[model samples]
Target: MTTALHLAKSDDLPKLSALVAAFHAESGIEISDEARTNGLAPLLNGIPHGAAYLLGPARAPVGYVIVSFGWSVEFGGMDGFVDELYLRPAVRGRGIATEVLLALPKALAEAGMKAIHLEVAADNATAQSLYERTGFRTRDGYRLMTRVL
Candidate 1:
């Protein structure tokens, strides 16, 4: 089945929050509602730092994706990292995520994004394969390291 991505707006917080909570729970990411809302609100409000999209029907979205932006000297311009991507359990294996990944970068590139990045668990071969098919490759010896601010 085909899917559509609606650029999320401030009014979309409630629905987007629900989807985000579901994704965090399913993925074992522990976070409070306030934190989630705090993180999501700015993006939905049009912060240049990132953007969010609702997948499927806007009023009753089945999933969501968020991409955060930053300058990358190696990439030579603005680059984006896929902060989160999730679809409801019922919609798994339908190529919906693949379609979103493919289409999202095209739009971002048009908006001057030089590269897009996402992290898949080392053991998640399924997601790795999906990412590979959609044109994401490992950075040879480079690994993503993070520190909580």
Candidate 2:
């Protein structure tokens, strides 16, 4: 599977949304379709805080990745978080996701992003290994805490 990242556009909403819904369902996230669409639209519209990418063919993407930018004083100026990443089950076990993880950050770095981060569930050893191989290390003692507003 190719790991080329195609920046998603406004017109790609329908397909992207469906993939997101499927991914969320598979991951057991219970967000409503309306909520997901509402959240994704602005990013597709080129919002500065975040961006979405369609992996492989744009028309029938094999996977998707969404990144949200922020200012992290600790990491320096601009930083980004891998808000989501999803590849079709049939396409897993390949190095496609690794390719994206390795390649995308260089592009982002050139664009002035200082750091990149992601969150993986504690029990998901496969994902943890993959992330570790790609240079994402657990920050010693830090944990990701969040508040839904």
Candidate 3:
């Protein structure tokens, strides 16, 4: 059996950091310790006000998901962004990630969120398929652009 772990407190930082670092490494995204530390501060503080959850056995975290809040006039109210999701390679094929994706919207709705969004790399067909299977569809009308300043 699998369990869902809700990380709603500052105490969850270490586990979250480890999981994110593992994900970055596995995905070939080079990140520094300081970057990871700085990046996790908001999630740890629960600032920008969001939640992180883990899926696996109760004591060990095999995967994690981070959700953040935002306003979307198009959705007619507050929406959620799935900021990050990562499951260990060994555990990838077991449908756990699919379960987490399915469950997150319900959890967010309970918190009064109206919608959820995520961005997967254009070439990442595996992830796109999973998202589509879970009710997320691509928006063809707009292009996602970003600038680092």
> Global lDDT of each model?
0.95, 0.92, 0.82
lDDT of 2 by residue, 1-149 (tens): 25678999999999899999989999999999899999999999988999999998867898899999999898789999999999999999889999999998889999999999999999999999999998889988899999988
Please give the ranking of all candidate structures by lDDT, highest first, separated by commas.
Answer: 1, 2, 3
Which scores higher on TM-score, 1 or 3? 1
Tens digit per residue, CA lDDT, model 3, 70-117? 999988888988988999888898888888888888877887899999
Selected candidate, larger lDDT, 1 vs 2 = 1
TM-score of each: 0.97, 0.97, 0.90
Superposed model 1: Cα runs more than 4 Å off: none
Candidate 3, which segments miss by more than 4 Å at Cα?
none
Question: Model 3 Cα displacement at 94 (Å)?
Answer: 0.6
The positional error of residue 19 in candidate 1, measured at the CA in angstroms, is 0.4
Overlapping backbone residue pairs in candidate 3 total 0
Q: What is the alpha-carbon lDDT of model 3 when measured against the actual structure? A: 0.82
For candidate 2, report its TM-score: 0.97
